[model samples]
Target chain A: MENTTKDYSHIKGWGIDADPKNDPTYPMKRRTNEEHLGYSWERPTLQPQTVEILHSNERPNVTAVFGTSTPPSGLSGMIRRLAFKKTENDYGHWLPLILADRINVVEGIIEDLRSGHVPNIFAEKGYKAEWKYNRGGLLRKAAVAAILSYGVVAYFRAKKKRKHNY
Target chain B: MLAMNYRGPLRVRASQKPMPKIEHPQDAIVRVTRSCICGSDLHLYNGSVPDTRVGMTFGHEFTGIVEEVGSEVTKIKVGDHVLVPFNIACGQCAFCKQELYGNCHESNPQATAVGGIFGYSHTAGGYNGGQAEYARVPYANVGPTIIPEGMDPDDAVLLTDVVPTGYQAAEMGGIQKGDTVVVFGAGPVGIMAAKCSWLFGAGRVIIIDQVDYRLEFARNYAQCEAYNFNEIGDPVLFLKKETDWMGADVCIDAVGAEAAGNAMQTITGRKLLLQAGSATAVHWAINSVKKGGIISIVGVYGPTDNLIPIGNVLNKGLTIRANQASVKRLLPRLIEHVQNGVLNPKGLITHRIPLEEVSDAYRIFSEKLDNCIKPILISPSAGL
Candidate 1:
């Protein structure tokens, strides 16, 4: 118990002896949800910086990192190039194009039915029908279309092999 | 900056402090022009109020000049002289929207207990008070009202807490015209309660206290009959006899937990810390009021329960009204009273000391030294 008569004149300002950290019962139970009290200390930046990622028209060399030497002839070479392209465009470029093609196919079917022209199932109307891919760099668009076409071919091939096994 | 630091019970000293900065978007850093020692502050000073952390600045009644405003604060601007209500309320809360500013939900997430009060303790939201060079006032737009033109800072300071509390005490009584009112505790609030009772058309008003000088001061200042409970044997019986055995129409408890009438109350409530500060005044108010009369309580007690005479209250069919003074709700009408000279809120200020001598101010006020009725702290640079 400190004496009440002690002169504190030497102390310059108030709160010199205030040690909130040391107080036994201190740091009183603050309200758990006081943050919602409309009072905030969050200082938002006045000007938020916007970063734009520019995808250059220059397509990345699809096989540069894996070695530029082409495999000798036929199926092996084709498989190498396909694998390289898959790795290079794996930044989700192919998925969107495949989904778009499926959606376009559905839309085209719907339009045929609406126009009362969907009569043939195995003619040029079905085989010659092409997916309308949206414009991009012509080479990149072609690559995206080829990726989807390959997926379809591979899927049919797998179905044929499964039928043979059965 | 110098501010009042609460060390322990009866232990406070002015010490060096840092200037408060804006901590929230709605906060305002107010350079204190005036602050006051309130009767309720005594609860914190004496360690009667639980969770009163050591080293906290202890002053709830204050008036100041805004030095800075947060980005979101628009109602008041830097350089505006403002009287900050003791209750810190966010104007948008459901309770605040309903004019119950003291029960503002958003301001103190501890709304289950009480709302944010400046400089009381952690239980009241841990907001540092204005017993310093500057204080950080949260929700500045809602809680602080600019002191009106030509109003004395003294009067403005009282309105921050004392005047509004006293006015609310009387308002809660539901005083009727030509009705007798008895106010317990001749402290500043009681005196103000006695005075404000007349405004509510109370035909007769009386104040009771154990202190002789306070009783005299209450009579002189409030213009009401004042009696020392020690001098008058059995305060309830005395009131009954004075009111023709019908009891007073309204009774108010202005003395909260630190009341000094009964031995058991003082022992259990004050000494043992078992109950909320002494319920002596509450008991007296309950017993002395007429059957079915309203008992207004502005006095503060702990969040914990007190051993009040609830059976007596129930049998008497008393309508007890108690709350932290909704200062904002009553401010507009109170300002009118101040403007018309119907209330002199500053008349209760009996001592004015510089902020640096706040410890001495606390001692004098706490010890009842030199007939101190109310002590106002003048900022060293306030030039008051």
Candidate 2:
């Protein structure tokens, strides 16, 4: 219960808040989120694009991280939004909404897959490959960053060790 | 009432000195019941005000009670609670009739934005400012607002400058129905512009800033989406992705050259490209807006070559409307919204202080303390 419930409630997708910063678990609730109705700020919503992610935790099983026009829905989607907010030290003004939007997209993909809504549901060979490619890309980036960090650390460590010897 | 006393760059110890008054039949005496510092007011403190003089009242953001009427004044009654929009226009003037109060021909027709501004130098009219107990307002019947019964002065006070400036940013930007709008800067005016965009039916309103504290406060309070311009290397690229590869339907230049850094010299010391820096804003506007979209400016500027790509806005078929908001025209509607609770305009006031503490208010607000968006000033203990 590390408060995994995301608070990315500011995101708007598919005609609703669709995200969790508005989720009740967090305090400092933004009272005006709903009050504004945001009539004047509305823009044509983006057509949800579908993508899949094979996020791994401790297991090697597929999480069915389907992508949709909007992000995934529910608390999990809120978590992703919060992750983006985390990037901006104190969370961005639109982080919640953006996070929520990403969540809605994921949720739509998942829902379509579950309901046989996506035409090439299982046979779409590209889905699995895309997921794997995304995972691989992320792994490669992380590995490069880790190697760079270690290289710098090792360089400093070796220099300090040699300085003592000298 | 006395002459329009101002806080000139030259420090005057005459805090007790009387202001000058006008006896023209067209003039009316207004006891300023409410007044607040404007971003332009800092021009004086910052030594940017041109041809400075003494006894000038520096505030342009004000609401007041009509204390006395001139012989020719007929529309406004004494004791009327009115929010004075900054631009002075004679209603009968050709431009005023067309609602172009900034270019009103009857009064100081040469006055920029239709006529003279209170406390501004000879560039506009040398009319006194509103930062005192009393000010003589010209064409009082035309500009003074009658606060409806039971309306809160704080809610309507901004009708003069900040509120309209904010609304004008949204309006003149030509916000399309369900168009995505983004505003750069989250200052009081920026936040109001974001809020007003929503009020104008924007599908999504985004605000960009590097101040984390301000982003947090605005997102939490104003319900706006915030972007970190500092973290985002290419704001335009990121914004395009955020809006499906279409830039903002409208972009507002709330942060003029000063905020953008010294790379962009300030046209004058006035904040962001209000009317003065329209050209500076024009450059960013052309880039931030989608082709055929509009970019509006509300920040103040002084005369200079804007260095804007004039052909771009025209080539893109982008509409550009830059003007100092005619407070007399926009305040009443803003007031009605406040009175009817259609919107909570008061929420914009992030801090409140007593009249004597106004100096502190100026310090904090100017320094942008604690996510200070807008601070309202009340008298010695007017129960603010």
Candidate 3:
């Protein structure tokens, strides 16, 4: 595989300390011949990659040990692939990735509902702690949620009443 | 084995747990001698970080004596005194090869960003930390460095996280000679960042925080100007005035999600969980930095979208470099600094509590009681 290293040399002082001599703390950091002692051992055997792994586009190959817990799938997976296409610095990359996470949470809830288990969102979201420690904040949030929900229901009910009068 | 147990937010207790054993070929079991409750741990304790399950241990900065090693572990040996870097990196990964140990691809491959970190919740990989009698260290060959001969264990424990993090915060700033650096937050990392800024030839260093004792500590320890942001009213404007309206050359956000100054940020980010912890310091940093100046963030924010002014970042042409400190990369030079007496890693410790009273340790640190700058937990089994 070809090494596709990104050139960030356009940025001023980029990789300035790539040469150790340029480091401002060079006076204090004397070179000890033993710097490599701990790092010189044989590499460990690679864990086999059995799951669908999503890696940054900049990398040439998958890492030796990749996580297999959650593979890219559904809408969030597609968004993640799109996210990986852009460099990390771009807002385009991060915003979509965050959106993907939010979508994944909703997907998880739907999946839980599909199965026999009824997800206890209150317990799962750590609301018990919120009620215990931050009762005022939790109450304020509940009040706001209640008002908004009531307004929506009232609006639709008034619309139905108006049609009947016509 | 006695370990810190996570009951819930603002809740931790000392509980008996089974002694850790080598789970992988590259693992090592260390009997923890010293472990520090990090500012980041408070994020877990405060319920700021997601996926921080109940019954999980929370600690990342630790030093210990190796008690056991896996079959494949060669560099580290049993009975060796060592300090473990918070990052868990397989030595051969592409990122690790480039000395970007914090972003090691293999360690936390489930996440799109950041590698595995011990006891940093499931978001950082579910590796139990060293706030116990024993800890299981994976990729042991790459992460654990033997503490140098005669190095104080207190200093050695800090080297695992705080020293390297603060040093890296300045390094990432790419500070030039005589540049003015303004650090936000006067916590250990912020104080260390201010102190290390001088090593990078910073002409002036100013640290900002709301806490009186911490500001005083920063003023004395870092030998830099320090101010209470609450007293200053507008931190960005004060920084601008201090720099003669030119703003600072570099601004660092050592305070992550739970910043307190901004009411709106506190309400939305901390109180409501609208966005990852408050980006208040980040907002201040971006606004106070000179156009084209650098902003280095070593603060631990949740892995989510933050409300920040990207328009200013682009218009000001500010350079932002942020990450979990690549501890392995910075360890050697930091160890040298400690040896030369240039950086006093142990002097940061103001509170030392036994591992059994881990709950009180968290409460004191969390509430900022006793003018605590740093706190270390002494394991009962240490030196046994």
**What TM-score would candidate 3 get against the native?**
0.75
Off by over 4 Å in 3: A1-43, A46-166
* Native contacts recovered, each model: 0.00, 0.00, 0.08
Collision count of model 1: 8
User: What value of lDDT does candidate 2 attain over all alpha carbons?
Assistant: 0.57
RMSD of each: 32.8, 27.7, 8.0
lDDT of 3: 0.80
Model 2 spans > 4 angstroms off: A1-166, B1-14, B20-22, B52-54, B109-114, B261-282, B354-359, B379-384
Per-model TM against the reference: 0.70, 0.63, 0.75
Which sections of candidate 1 miss by over 4 Å?
A: A1-166
**Candidate 1: docking tier:** incorrect
**Order of candidates by DockQ, top first?**
3, 2, 1
lDDT (C-alpha) at residue A105 in model 2: 39
Spell out the clash pairs found in candidate 3. B257-B277, B257-B278
Candidate 2 iRMSD, 1 decimal = 31.5
lDDT for B25 in candidate 2 is: 54
lDDT of 2 by residue, B1-384 (tens): 222233323221113335434445556667666676666665454434332333344666677777788777788888777777787666664445546665443443112232556656433444556666666787776777787788777777777777787887888776768988888777777778888888888999888877887888668656889977778766777788887877788888776533552234344323432223333344655677888887777666543235567787777787766677766666667777777776566677777755444444555565565467777655431222
- Residues A1-166, candidate 3, lDDT per residue (tens digit)? 0122557767898765565455432222333322244434344566555556655554454544433334566887788778767754555655676566557656655665797656554553445545654578779999999999999999999999999999
Top lDDT model? 3
Q: Over the stretch B270-356, how does candidate 3's per-residue lDDT look in tens digits? A: 887777889899999999999999999998888666898989999999988887888888888899999999999899999988888
